[model samples]
Target: MARLPVNHPARPIYRVLSGLVGLYILVFGVWGTVLTWGEPPFARDGAWALGLRANLAFALVSVIFGIVLIVGASRRGNLGHYMNLTAGVVFLVTSILMMSVLQTSANFLNFSMSTVIVSMLFGLILIGTGAYDKVGPEEHAEEARKHRFHPVAEVHRRR
Candidate 1:
Protein backbone atom coordinates (compact mmCIF):
# COMPACT_ATOMS: atom_id res chain seq x y z
CA MET A 1 0.00 0.00 0.00
CA ALA A 2 1.18 3.50 -0.72
CA ARG A 3 1.78 5.45 2.45
CA LEU A 4 0.74 9.03 2.83
CA PRO A 5 3.25 11.79 3.44
CA VAL A 6 3.78 12.74 7.08
CA ASN A 7 2.00 16.06 6.75
CA HIS A 8 -0.55 14.67 4.31
CA PRO A 9 -3.39 14.92 6.83
CA ALA A 10 -4.27 11.50 5.51
CA ARG A 11 -2.38 9.83 8.32
CA PRO A 12 0.41 10.65 10.76
CA ILE A 13 0.34 12.62 14.04
CA TYR A 14 3.89 12.47 15.38
CA ARG A 15 4.34 16.18 14.93
CA VAL A 16 2.07 17.04 17.81
CA LEU A 17 2.53 14.00 20.07
CA SER A 18 6.30 13.97 19.86
CA GLY A 19 6.49 17.69 20.24
CA LEU A 20 4.55 17.49 23.47
CA VAL A 21 6.43 14.52 24.87
CA GLY A 22 9.75 16.01 23.89
CA LEU A 23 8.92 19.31 25.47
CA TYR A 24 7.83 17.61 28.67
CA ILE A 25 10.93 15.45 28.90
CA LEU A 26 13.16 18.36 28.07
CA VAL A 27 11.66 20.48 30.78
CA PHE A 28 11.69 17.63 33.25
CA GLY A 29 15.34 16.93 32.65
CA VAL A 30 16.31 20.54 33.14
CA TRP A 31 14.20 20.81 36.24
CA GLY A 32 15.66 17.62 37.66
CA THR A 33 19.18 18.86 37.14
CA VAL A 34 18.45 22.21 38.72
CA LEU A 35 17.04 20.47 41.75
CA THR A 36 19.80 17.91 42.03
CA TRP A 37 22.70 20.16 41.27
CA GLY A 38 25.57 20.32 43.78
CA GLU A 39 24.74 16.72 44.55
CA PRO A 40 26.46 13.56 43.31
CA PRO A 41 26.17 12.69 39.65
CA PHE A 42 25.17 9.16 40.52
CA ALA A 43 23.37 9.09 43.80
CA ARG A 44 21.89 6.31 45.91
CA ASP A 45 18.46 7.84 45.30
CA GLY A 46 18.52 7.35 41.56
CA ALA A 47 16.42 5.35 39.14
CA TRP A 48 17.55 2.46 36.87
CA ALA A 49 20.07 -0.27 37.58
CA LEU A 50 23.16 1.83 36.91
CA GLY A 51 22.08 4.43 39.43
CA LEU A 52 21.31 6.93 36.72
CA ARG A 53 20.69 10.23 38.44
CA ALA A 54 18.94 13.28 37.10
CA ASN A 55 22.09 15.39 37.15
CA LEU A 56 23.90 17.31 34.43
CA ALA A 57 24.45 14.37 32.11
CA PHE A 58 20.80 13.37 32.05
CA ALA A 59 19.72 16.98 31.64
CA LEU A 60 21.94 17.50 28.59
CA VAL A 61 20.59 14.36 27.00
CA SER A 62 17.04 15.49 27.66
CA VAL A 63 17.68 18.89 26.11
CA ILE A 64 19.20 17.27 23.07
CA PHE A 65 16.25 14.88 22.77
CA GLY A 66 13.81 17.77 22.98
CA ILE A 67 15.70 19.72 20.34
CA VAL A 68 15.60 16.72 18.04
CA LEU A 69 11.82 16.51 18.19
CA ILE A 70 11.27 20.26 17.90
CA VAL A 71 13.67 20.53 14.98
CA GLY A 72 12.31 17.43 13.26
CA ALA A 73 8.71 18.47 13.80
CA SER A 74 8.11 19.08 10.13
CA ARG A 75 9.23 15.59 9.19
CA ARG A 76 6.18 13.65 8.04
CA GLY A 77 5.29 10.02 7.39
CA ASN A 78 7.52 6.98 7.63
CA LEU A 79 10.70 8.31 9.17
CA GLY A 80 8.88 10.36 11.75
CA HIS A 81 6.48 7.55 12.59
CA TYR A 82 9.26 5.00 13.00
CA MET A 83 11.28 7.29 15.22
CA ASN A 84 8.28 8.01 17.41
CA LEU A 85 7.31 4.36 17.45
CA THR A 86 10.70 3.25 18.65
CA ALA A 87 10.97 6.00 21.24
CA GLY A 88 7.45 5.35 22.45
CA VAL A 89 8.11 1.69 22.97
CA VAL A 90 11.28 2.37 24.89
CA PHE A 91 9.71 5.02 27.07
CA LEU A 92 6.66 2.90 27.73
CA VAL A 93 8.70 -0.02 28.91
CA THR A 94 10.94 2.07 31.10
CA SER A 95 8.08 3.98 32.62
CA ILE A 96 6.13 0.82 33.35
CA LEU A 97 9.12 -0.79 34.95
CA MET A 98 9.87 2.24 37.06
CA MET A 99 6.30 2.51 38.21
CA SER A 100 6.01 -1.17 39.05
CA VAL A 101 9.10 -1.26 41.21
CA LEU A 102 9.25 0.06 44.71
CA GLN A 103 12.67 1.55 45.15
CA THR A 104 14.41 3.98 47.41
CA SER A 105 13.08 7.43 48.15
CA ALA A 106 14.43 9.27 45.17
CA ASN A 107 12.87 11.93 43.00
CA PHE A 108 13.97 12.50 39.44
CA LEU A 109 12.60 15.77 38.16
CA ASN A 110 10.46 15.76 41.24
CA PHE A 111 8.25 13.16 39.66
CA SER A 112 5.08 12.46 41.57
CA MET A 113 2.32 9.96 40.88
CA SER A 114 0.93 12.43 38.38
CA THR A 115 4.22 12.46 36.58
CA VAL A 116 4.15 8.73 36.11
CA ILE A 117 0.62 8.93 34.76
CA VAL A 118 1.63 11.66 32.36
CA SER A 119 4.57 9.62 31.15
CA MET A 120 2.30 6.69 30.50
CA LEU A 121 -0.05 8.92 28.56
CA PHE A 122 2.82 10.30 26.52
CA GLY A 123 3.98 6.82 25.61
CA LEU A 124 0.49 5.86 24.50
CA ILE A 125 0.20 9.00 22.41
CA LEU A 126 3.44 8.24 20.65
CA ILE A 127 2.40 4.68 19.95
CA GLY A 128 -1.06 5.62 18.78
CA THR A 129 0.15 8.41 16.52
CA GLY A 130 2.86 6.29 14.97
CA ALA A 131 1.53 2.77 14.78
CA TYR A 132 -1.91 3.33 13.33
CA ASP A 133 -2.71 4.17 9.74
CA LYS A 134 -3.24 7.89 9.35
CA VAL A 135 -4.67 7.81 5.86
CA GLY A 136 -8.25 8.91 5.34
CA PRO A 137 -10.65 7.08 3.06
CA GLU A 138 -10.80 9.92 0.56
CA GLU A 139 -7.02 10.26 0.47
CA HIS A 140 -6.62 6.55 0.12
CA ALA A 141 -8.95 6.53 -2.85
CA GLU A 142 -7.09 9.44 -4.41
CA GLU A 143 -3.81 7.66 -4.02
CA ALA A 144 -5.33 4.57 -5.55
CA ARG A 145 -6.56 6.56 -8.48
CA LYS A 146 -3.10 8.03 -9.05
CA HIS A 147 -1.38 4.65 -8.88
CA ARG A 148 -4.07 2.46 -10.35
CA PHE A 149 -2.78 -0.32 -12.66
CA HIS A 150 0.78 0.30 -11.43
CA PRO A 151 2.54 -2.86 -10.28
CA VAL A 152 3.33 -2.52 -6.60
CA ALA A 153 4.55 -6.10 -6.22
CA GLU A 154 8.12 -6.81 -7.26
CA VAL A 155 8.57 -9.11 -10.25
CA HIS A 156 11.41 -11.62 -10.19
CA ARG A 157 13.30 -12.53 -13.35
CA ARG A 158 14.89 -15.91 -13.75
CA ARG A 159 18.45 -15.66 -14.99
Candidate 2:
Protein backbone atom coordinates (compact mmCIF):
# COMPACT_ATOMS: atom_id res chain seq x y z
CA MET A 1 0.00 0.00 0.00
CA ALA A 2 1.16 3.52 -0.74
CA ARG A 3 1.59 6.05 2.02
CA LEU A 4 -0.34 9.32 2.01
CA PRO A 5 1.34 12.67 2.47
CA VAL A 6 1.38 13.90 6.04
CA ASN A 7 -0.80 16.84 5.07
CA HIS A 8 -2.19 16.12 1.63
CA PRO A 9 -5.93 15.58 1.64
CA ALA A 10 -8.23 13.64 -0.61
CA ARG A 11 -10.57 16.54 -1.22
CA PRO A 12 -12.24 15.03 -4.31
CA ILE A 13 -13.05 11.91 -2.36
CA TYR A 14 -14.59 13.92 0.43
CA ARG A 15 -16.61 15.93 -2.03
CA VAL A 16 -18.02 12.77 -3.59
CA LEU A 17 -18.89 11.36 -0.20
CA SER A 18 -20.90 14.45 0.70
CA GLY A 19 -22.67 14.37 -2.65
CA LEU A 20 -23.52 10.71 -2.28
CA VAL A 21 -24.99 11.24 1.17
CA GLY A 22 -27.09 14.04 -0.25
CA LEU A 23 -28.34 11.76 -3.02
CA TYR A 24 -29.45 9.20 -0.47
CA ILE A 25 -31.37 11.87 1.44
CA LEU A 26 -32.94 13.13 -1.77
CA VAL A 27 -34.30 9.68 -2.52
CA PHE A 28 -35.65 9.31 0.98
CA GLY A 29 -37.34 12.72 0.81
CA VAL A 30 -39.08 11.88 -2.44
CA TRP A 31 -40.18 8.52 -1.10
CA GLY A 32 -41.54 10.03 2.06
CA THR A 33 -43.56 12.81 0.41
CA VAL A 34 -45.02 10.76 -2.43
CA LEU A 35 -48.66 11.78 -2.17
CA THR A 36 -49.10 14.17 0.74
CA TRP A 37 -48.41 17.12 -1.55
CA GLY A 38 -45.91 18.57 0.95
CA GLU A 39 -48.33 18.35 3.84
CA PRO A 40 -45.55 17.07 6.09
CA PRO A 41 -41.91 17.62 5.47
CA PHE A 42 -40.95 16.22 8.83
CA ALA A 43 -43.77 13.80 9.42
CA ARG A 44 -43.15 10.67 11.39
CA ASP A 45 -44.67 7.91 9.27
CA GLY A 46 -43.57 5.35 11.78
CA ALA A 47 -40.91 4.18 9.37
CA TRP A 48 -37.76 2.73 10.84
CA ALA A 49 -34.27 4.28 10.52
CA LEU A 50 -31.55 2.25 12.13
CA GLY A 51 -34.45 0.50 13.90
CA LEU A 52 -36.01 3.81 14.97
CA ARG A 53 -38.78 5.83 13.36
CA ALA A 54 -37.57 8.91 11.46
CA ASN A 55 -39.37 12.21 10.91
CA LEU A 56 -40.66 13.16 7.48
CA ALA A 57 -39.45 16.68 7.99
CA PHE A 58 -35.95 15.43 8.42
CA ALA A 59 -36.19 13.82 5.02
CA LEU A 60 -37.43 17.02 3.40
CA VAL A 61 -34.64 19.04 4.92
CA SER A 62 -32.17 16.31 4.05
CA VAL A 63 -33.15 16.52 0.37
CA ILE A 64 -32.53 20.23 0.27
CA PHE A 65 -29.26 19.78 2.08
CA GLY A 66 -28.37 16.95 -0.21
CA ILE A 67 -28.62 19.23 -3.21
CA VAL A 68 -26.58 21.85 -1.46
CA LEU A 69 -23.90 19.39 -0.42
CA ILE A 70 -23.68 17.82 -3.87
CA VAL A 71 -23.31 21.18 -5.57
CA GLY A 72 -20.80 22.44 -3.04
CA ALA A 73 -18.70 19.31 -3.01
CA SER A 74 -18.53 19.15 -6.79
CA ARG A 75 -16.88 22.52 -6.98
CA ARG A 76 -13.10 22.84 -6.82
CA GLY A 77 -12.92 25.38 -4.04
CA ASN A 78 -13.05 25.82 -0.28
CA LEU A 79 -16.85 25.85 -0.41
CA GLY A 80 -16.95 22.09 -0.95
CA HIS A 81 -15.08 21.42 2.25
CA TYR A 82 -17.22 23.92 4.10
CA MET A 83 -20.42 22.13 3.10
CA ASN A 84 -18.93 18.78 4.08
CA LEU A 85 -17.96 20.09 7.48
CA THR A 86 -21.35 21.66 8.07
CA ALA A 87 -23.34 18.58 7.12
CA GLY A 88 -21.01 16.30 9.00
CA VAL A 89 -21.30 18.34 12.18
CA VAL A 90 -25.07 18.49 11.94
CA PHE A 91 -25.34 14.75 11.45
CA LEU A 92 -23.02 14.09 14.35
CA VAL A 93 -24.99 16.34 16.66
CA THR A 94 -28.33 14.99 15.57
CA SER A 95 -27.20 11.41 16.05
CA ILE A 96 -25.87 12.03 19.53
CA LEU A 97 -28.90 14.09 20.56
CA MET A 98 -31.29 11.48 19.23
CA MET A 99 -29.71 8.76 21.30
CA SER A 100 -29.20 10.81 24.44
CA VAL A 101 -31.43 13.88 24.52
CA LEU A 102 -34.63 12.28 23.28
CA GLN A 103 -36.45 9.65 25.32
CA THR A 104 -35.78 6.07 24.33
CA SER A 105 -39.44 5.51 23.60
CA ALA A 106 -39.53 8.45 21.26
CA ASN A 107 -38.73 6.54 18.12
CA PHE A 108 -40.57 9.23 16.16
CA LEU A 109 -37.29 9.58 14.31
CA ASN A 110 -34.49 7.08 14.10
CA PHE A 111 -32.70 8.55 17.02
CA SER A 112 -32.12 4.97 18.02
CA MET A 113 -28.79 3.43 18.88
CA SER A 114 -28.16 2.46 15.27
CA THR A 115 -28.65 5.98 13.91
CA VAL A 116 -26.62 7.39 16.72
CA ILE A 117 -23.66 5.27 15.79
CA VAL A 118 -24.01 5.60 12.03
CA SER A 119 -24.62 9.30 12.05
CA MET A 120 -21.74 9.91 14.40
CA LEU A 121 -19.43 7.88 12.23
CA PHE A 122 -20.39 9.71 9.03
CA GLY A 123 -20.25 13.04 10.79
CA LEU A 124 -16.69 12.45 11.90
CA ILE A 125 -15.65 11.34 8.42
CA LEU A 126 -17.03 14.52 6.90
CA ILE A 127 -15.29 16.61 9.46
CA GLY A 128 -11.99 14.86 8.88
CA THR A 129 -12.30 15.10 5.11
CA GLY A 130 -13.13 18.78 5.24
CA ALA A 131 -10.09 19.54 7.35
CA TYR A 132 -7.74 18.88 4.42
CA ASP A 133 -8.90 22.08 2.79
CA LYS A 134 -7.67 24.30 5.60
CA VAL A 135 -4.28 22.59 5.59
CA GLY A 136 -3.80 23.54 1.93
CA PRO A 137 -3.30 21.02 -0.85
CA GLU A 138 0.08 19.41 -0.73
CA GLU A 139 1.28 16.51 -2.88
CA HIS A 140 -0.69 13.51 -4.08
CA ALA A 141 -0.55 10.33 -2.06
CA GLU A 142 1.38 8.52 -4.81
CA GLU A 143 3.89 11.32 -5.23
CA ALA A 144 4.50 11.49 -1.53
CA ARG A 145 4.80 7.76 -1.38
CA LYS A 146 7.54 7.84 -3.99
CA HIS A 147 9.55 10.17 -1.80
CA ARG A 148 8.55 8.57 1.47
CA PHE A 149 11.88 6.95 2.29
CA HIS A 150 14.12 9.16 0.18
CA PRO A 151 16.32 11.88 1.61
CA VAL A 152 17.77 14.97 0.07
CA ALA A 153 20.30 14.07 -2.62
CA GLU A 154 22.48 17.13 -1.95
CA VAL A 155 22.78 19.77 0.73
CA HIS A 156 24.10 23.23 0.00
CA ARG A 157 26.05 25.05 2.68
CA ARG A 158 25.80 28.83 2.75
CA ARG A 159 28.86 30.60 4.02
Candidate 3:
Protein backbone atom coordinates (compact mmCIF):
# COMPACT_ATOMS: atom_id res chain seq x y z
CA MET A 1 0.00 0.00 0.00
CA ALA A 2 1.18 3.51 -0.74
CA ARG A 3 2.01 5.67 2.22
CA LEU A 4 -0.42 8.52 2.87
CA PRO A 5 1.04 12.01 2.48
CA VAL A 6 0.56 15.03 4.71
CA ASN A 7 -2.37 17.01 3.37
CA HIS A 8 -2.75 20.44 4.94
CA PRO A 9 -0.60 23.57 4.75
CA ALA A 10 -1.47 24.40 8.36
CA ARG A 11 -2.29 21.00 9.70
CA PRO A 12 -0.33 21.54 12.87
CA ILE A 13 -2.03 24.89 13.48
CA TYR A 14 -5.39 23.28 12.90
CA ARG A 15 -4.60 20.50 15.33
CA VAL A 16 -3.38 22.85 18.04
CA LEU A 17 -6.30 25.25 17.63
CA SER A 18 -8.78 22.42 17.52
CA GLY A 19 -7.33 20.82 20.63
CA LEU A 20 -7.36 24.13 22.48
CA VAL A 21 -10.98 24.70 21.51
CA GLY A 22 -11.80 21.19 22.66
CA LEU A 23 -10.25 21.88 26.02
CA TYR A 24 -12.27 25.09 26.25
CA ILE A 25 -15.43 23.14 25.57
CA LEU A 26 -14.61 20.69 28.33
CA VAL A 27 -13.99 23.51 30.77
CA PHE A 28 -17.17 25.31 29.74
CA GLY A 29 -19.13 22.13 30.16
CA VAL A 30 -17.95 21.73 33.72
CA TRP A 31 -18.75 25.36 34.44
CA GLY A 32 -22.23 25.13 32.90
CA THR A 33 -22.98 21.93 34.77
CA VAL A 34 -22.09 23.61 37.99
CA LEU A 35 -24.16 26.70 37.23
CA THR A 36 -27.27 24.75 36.30
CA TRP A 37 -27.10 22.17 39.03
CA GLY A 38 -30.34 23.17 40.72
CA GLU A 39 -33.81 22.84 39.28
CA PRO A 40 -34.11 26.58 38.95
CA PRO A 41 -37.28 28.04 37.54
CA PHE A 42 -36.95 29.11 33.94
CA ALA A 43 -38.23 32.51 32.84
CA ARG A 44 -40.41 31.65 29.90
CA ASP A 45 -42.72 28.74 29.43
CA GLY A 46 -43.29 27.84 25.77
CA ALA A 47 -40.69 29.00 23.25
CA TRP A 48 -38.18 29.94 25.91
CA ALA A 49 -38.30 26.55 27.58
CA LEU A 50 -37.85 24.85 24.24
CA GLY A 51 -34.86 27.01 23.46
CA LEU A 52 -33.34 26.47 26.85
CA ARG A 53 -33.70 22.72 26.63
CA ALA A 54 -32.26 22.63 23.14
CA ASN A 55 -29.32 24.76 24.18
CA LEU A 56 -28.70 22.55 27.16
CA ALA A 57 -28.80 19.46 25.02
CA PHE A 58 -26.44 21.03 22.51
CA ALA A 59 -24.01 22.01 25.25
CA LEU A 60 -24.01 18.43 26.49
CA VAL A 61 -23.34 17.23 22.96
CA SER A 62 -20.50 19.75 22.71
CA VAL A 63 -18.97 18.25 25.80
CA ILE A 64 -19.10 14.81 24.24
CA PHE A 65 -17.49 16.13 21.05
CA GLY A 66 -14.82 17.84 23.14
CA ILE A 67 -13.87 14.51 24.62
CA VAL A 68 -13.74 12.97 21.14
CA LEU A 69 -11.57 15.83 19.89
CA ILE A 70 -9.14 15.47 22.76
CA VAL A 71 -8.72 11.85 21.78
CA GLY A 72 -8.74 12.36 17.99
CA ALA A 73 -6.22 15.22 18.05
CA SER A 74 -3.54 12.95 19.50
CA ARG A 75 -3.80 10.47 16.63
CA ARG A 76 -3.02 10.78 12.94
CA GLY A 77 -5.48 11.94 10.27
CA ASN A 78 -7.41 15.23 10.45
CA LEU A 79 -7.54 17.05 13.74
CA GLY A 80 -11.04 18.33 13.19
CA HIS A 81 -12.74 14.99 12.62
CA TYR A 82 -16.22 14.54 11.10
CA MET A 83 -17.99 14.06 14.41
CA ASN A 84 -16.40 17.24 15.75
CA LEU A 85 -17.64 19.33 12.84
CA THR A 86 -21.15 17.94 12.96
CA ALA A 87 -21.50 18.59 16.67
CA GLY A 88 -19.90 22.00 16.37
CA VAL A 89 -22.36 23.18 13.73
CA VAL A 90 -25.27 21.99 15.77
CA PHE A 91 -23.89 23.71 18.84
CA LEU A 92 -23.06 27.01 17.15
CA VAL A 93 -26.49 27.56 15.65
CA THR A 94 -28.40 26.44 18.70
CA SER A 95 -26.31 28.47 21.08
CA ILE A 96 -26.71 31.75 19.22
CA LEU A 97 -30.45 31.34 18.96
CA MET A 98 -30.78 30.39 22.59
CA MET A 99 -28.68 33.27 23.83
CA SER A 100 -30.63 35.82 21.85
CA VAL A 101 -33.85 34.62 23.34
CA LEU A 102 -32.59 34.13 26.87
CA GLN A 103 -30.90 37.42 27.41
CA THR A 104 -33.29 39.86 29.04
CA SER A 105 -31.27 42.03 31.41
CA ALA A 106 -27.92 43.78 31.27
CA ASN A 107 -26.92 41.61 34.17
CA PHE A 108 -26.47 38.79 31.71
CA LEU A 109 -23.84 40.61 29.65
CA ASN A 110 -20.95 38.55 30.96
CA PHE A 111 -22.81 35.32 30.43
CA SER A 112 -23.85 36.38 26.97
CA MET A 113 -20.35 37.39 25.96
CA SER A 114 -18.89 34.16 27.23
CA THR A 115 -21.45 32.12 25.33
CA VAL A 116 -20.85 33.96 22.08
CA ILE A 117 -17.10 33.68 22.39
CA VAL A 118 -17.18 29.98 23.05
CA SER A 119 -19.78 29.34 20.34
CA MET A 120 -17.79 31.27 17.75
CA LEU A 121 -14.60 29.49 18.71
CA PHE A 122 -16.35 26.16 18.40
CA GLY A 123 -17.65 27.11 14.96
CA LEU A 124 -14.19 28.09 13.78
CA ILE A 125 -12.78 24.81 15.06
CA LEU A 126 -15.53 22.94 13.24
CA ILE A 127 -14.94 24.67 9.94
CA GLY A 128 -11.19 24.21 10.25
CA THR A 129 -11.60 20.55 11.09
CA GLY A 130 -13.89 20.00 8.11
CA ALA A 131 -11.38 21.65 5.81
CA TYR A 132 -8.57 19.59 7.24
CA ASP A 133 -10.51 16.37 6.81
CA LYS A 134 -11.27 17.25 3.21
CA VAL A 135 -7.56 17.66 2.44
CA GLY A 136 -5.76 15.52 5.03
CA PRO A 137 -4.16 12.19 4.29
CA GLU A 138 -5.40 8.85 5.54
CA GLU A 139 -3.20 5.83 6.13
CA HIS A 140 -4.30 2.48 4.76
CA ALA A 141 -4.53 -0.67 6.86
CA GLU A 142 -3.51 -2.89 3.94
CA GLU A 143 -0.30 -3.71 5.73
CA ALA A 144 -2.32 -4.91 8.67
CA ARG A 145 -4.39 -7.36 6.62
CA LYS A 146 -2.58 -10.19 8.39
CA HIS A 147 -4.37 -9.09 11.56
CA ARG A 148 -8.17 -9.02 11.99
CA PHE A 149 -8.67 -5.32 12.08
CA HIS A 150 -11.05 -2.86 10.45
CA PRO A 151 -9.40 0.48 9.76
CA VAL A 152 -10.72 3.98 10.39
CA ALA A 153 -9.59 4.90 6.89
CA GLU A 154 -12.05 2.47 5.29
CA VAL A 155 -14.89 3.76 7.42
CA HIS A 156 -14.18 7.38 6.42
CA ARG A 157 -13.66 6.40 2.81
CA ARG A 158 -17.31 5.38 2.55
CA ARG A 159 -18.28 8.88 3.65
Per-model tally of clashing residue pairs: 5, 9, 0
Regions of model 2 farther than 4 Å from truth: 1-9, 35-45, 49-52, 104-110, 133-159
Error of 3 at 122 (Å): 2.2
Query: What pairs collide in candidate 2?
Result: 41-56, 41-57, 42-56, 42-57, 43-56, 43-57, 53-109, 53-110, 54-109
Could you give candidate 2's per-residue lDDT for residues 34-141 as a string of tens digits?
532454544545555323345666556656866786787677766766777787889888886787755655544434466577678878877876665433345554
The TM-score that candidate 2 achieves is 0.64
For 23-113, candidate 1 gives per-residue lDDT tens digits of: 7777766676676667666443443211234555556666787666555444653566676777778668867765764254544332334
Off by over 4 Å in 1: 1-14, 44-58, 104-112, 132-159
The estimated TM-scores of all candidates read 0.58, 0.64, 0.52
lDDT, ranked from best to worst: 2, 1, 3
Model 1 score (lDDT): 0.58
Which lDDT value does model 1 have at 46? Answer: 47
Candidate lDDT (C-alpha), each: 0.58, 0.61, 0.53
Q: Put the candidates in TM-score order, highest first.
A: 2, 1, 3
Q: What is candidate 3's lDDT per residue for 1-159, written digit by digit as tens?
A: 433223545666666776777776666555544444443323122211212221344345556767877776655654445655675687688567647755565322223445566576677666656556434323423333322234766676689
Query: Candidate 1 or 3, higher lDDT?
Result: 1
Highest TM-score: which candidate? Answer: 2
